[model samples]
Target: MRASHNQHLIHEVLQWNGVIARRAHLDLSQTIGRMLRAGELVALLPGVYTWARWAGDPTVRLLAVAAWSPDAVVCRLAAARLTFWPEVDHGELDLAVSDRRCSAKGFRLHRRRLPPEHIVGWPLLGEDAATDGRGIVPITGPALTAVDLCAELGGEPIDRVLRSRQARLADLRGALECTAHRSGNRDRRRVLVESRAEPWSAAERKGHRLLFEAGIGGWFANFEVAVGGKTYYLDIAFPHLKLAVEIDGRFHEDDPDQFQSDRERQNAVQLAGWFVLRFTWYDLVDRPKVVIAQIRAALARCRKLAGIR
Candidate 1:
């Protein structure tokens, strides 16, 4: 298509206020009609059409949606999704708009005014346009996205906060700094700090600490053992007693090859006469006492076999 026609299409999709001149050469309305009739484009929102089968970045779609509504801003999990922060799995679009605007049928709209500080610089479709696909509107930055998530979570889902593989200490710190500068909610700032203090996958660390607290001796954190001239790492190990403990998370069961490899390693260790104990998320969350008991029993058996108290 010609550059002028493409601009006209974008303008039509965005419902630009300017009147089209009578002398304009390309008929935008007919062009759009033909494209839709041919299945070349689909209307994702009123006045917002995308090419059929355009499975480009979700951020791009969100940006297009925001373009369809100039007043809309990205918010909540939608913003976090753009920044690649792992938290809640919200499958819907969340947009923030001026309080005077009514919520759209398919979109969740939060009515609030975003301060200049909370808004970050993003490349909109136009040069110097103040929007991005990363958040409610492109105006939401990484720091704002993190703060919004922390606020929404009430800081309780610490594990999910840590599991955000994209969220870094620095990003969180930057968000907090912005929060402080903007004088946002004090409680939210405190929660952000607490969230930043530890890794996202803290459940694993907590499980490890609980075992130590339960008086399980000879256990080392992140312990490496050399068996048959090959190095293997254990979450917890009593090397002298030939005991190994493996802590399994949900993702551990998802990978068949890793599961098989783990089984082989366990067999090799057992063939060497070492006791192997495995713990899962269920064990850690629902049956801590049972986990400790199992470990203690394994240690006792190892001691008995070695003739040691």
Candidate 2:
């Protein structure tokens, strides 16, 4: 068959899905081989090929990468972007493998012996079954993703993920125990420590640490109270004394809506007869001594008002 005729046939097959694997049939194999040789088709993997137009697309590239190595699991930023936290940015797709290598251009490869618990199976939806073959790709779970990124980007990103309810501290610890090596052990441990061993936001965690270090006790993190028929959580609260402490981070200042919501929540807490104390990120971080002293004064006032010792 003429190259143009073969190219037309290849486009016809590719139209169903933008990518496909090499087939065993003689005539079809010869046509695909000719197209590849002529640079009309791009080979993403040993047996995988796609039309040049689809090669540059990230989703298509991810699909191709996943299809190329069923054993490989997507990790770090790529896995974070796939889950509850979709805003994670990285130029290269991270894939965890066991000593295997790929010559693909846009991948940041990590060759590690990942435990089965670290790897979770996920389906790539909206692809042709014939091309994708069950469409199951292995990727790192939320906890592992947090640990992976924490090693590189530090605790802020992991703290954000945990605060947003994207991952849990218990899971992060488990992954750390399973996967953390000697080189980055301190960073991993620092993330856990800076979090004050809590799953809340970075600022709240710092506040918890400050309170503990100052010998303050009998307060609960994420204390729940009902207000206006809706249950609201206080960053830190002494329920018996009817006192609530809110730790506001940079997000509150950056997002006007969040700043307004903080005010509304404070009003609702006060309406429920609780004394509310608000502190900024800097108050807990840069001015921990002052933050603790203020909390102590507030608690003493609250106790005297409530007729407590």
Candidate 3:
């Protein structure tokens, strides 16, 4: 009966969090050994195991790494996924360890010293993470994660982190300074400087650069505007003149439903006392002069109507 009870307990851990930490179950050593020998489980790290089927899951690998080093902060691609970029996939678990930086089977450790401001306890995703047994894991903070990923991903992750509102421009600046000695940092610095406008998309970045070169100021990118019951985020907003620049990127071009949705959204914003100018990738790329002239004319008309000098 006692042996059967041990099996039941082990099964519960596998189903809930997808891995059983040997450190968390010292008393179940014999049972774990039996399970390993019988092929009921596969080792994820030095002391972490999960069902054979779940051994390949990224989250399971992360959990297994966390089990191996509870104090280690989740870093790199794993940190990106957890913090801002959920689209990151097929990466190994990377952890920042303050202690011995040992490379294990399923995960690797990064030897680094992170300040207290760069680590935070976040709920690690699991089968029942939102339920009563919410096991929070220590992970790298969003700004640090963004900076760390900049070496491989470059500027995109930083904008994504800002878009998520998890980290601010100041936070990213601080993180960039901390990692200045790292490779490709000159380009990273350039990207950081360009990040002042905080454009959230590639096309928005192009639009922002054009405006900057033309010496146009007082515009906010990805500005939040509450129109009616639905909250709308304008690609660019000049609040003083109530002018919005909508960048119709590739995502807005391919989807039929999204095209209709964008029109509906444009109509709603128009009704809310705002003038919107819609531009596409081709418009900005092919004839930027024309686009700029249109914007200047619109600005002049808006200022004239508002009686602003």
Best model number under TM-score: 2
Cand. 1 TM to true fold: 0.50
Model 3 regions lying over 4 Å from their true place:
1-9, 12-17, 99-101, 125-134, 178-180, 307-309
Model 1 Cα lDDT, one tens digit per residue, 155-261 = 53433444444445566666566545343467666665544334334445556656657866566644566678877666567888878887777578898997888
Using Cα atoms with residue i matched to residue i, what is each candidate's TM-score against the true structure?
A: 0.50, 0.86, 0.84
Clash pairs for candidate 1? 73-136, 73-137, 74-135, 74-136, 74-137, 75-136, 131-138, 132-138, 162-200
**Model 3: worst 10 consecutive residues (lDDT sum):** 126-135
Clashes of 2: 0
Prediction RMSDs, each to the true structure: 8.4, 3.0, 3.1
Report the candidate with higher lDDT, 2 versus 3.
Answer: 3
Off by over 4 Å in 2: 1-17, 23-27, 37-39, 126-133, 180-182, 196-199
**lDDT tens string, model 3, 1-309?**
877899999999888777898878988878998999999898877778999888887667766765667678788778878878888773567778877645677567777777777887766674367465455667788998887777677678887898899999999889877766776777777887778898776677779888998888889998887877898888888999999999887566688997888798889899999999999988889989998999999999999999997
Residue 62 CA displacement from its true place in model 2, Å: 1.5
The candidate that achieves the highest lDDT relative to the unseen native structure: 3
Estimate every model's Cα lDDT from 0 to 1: 0.61, 0.77, 0.81
Write down the worst ten-residue block by lDDT for model 2: 125-134
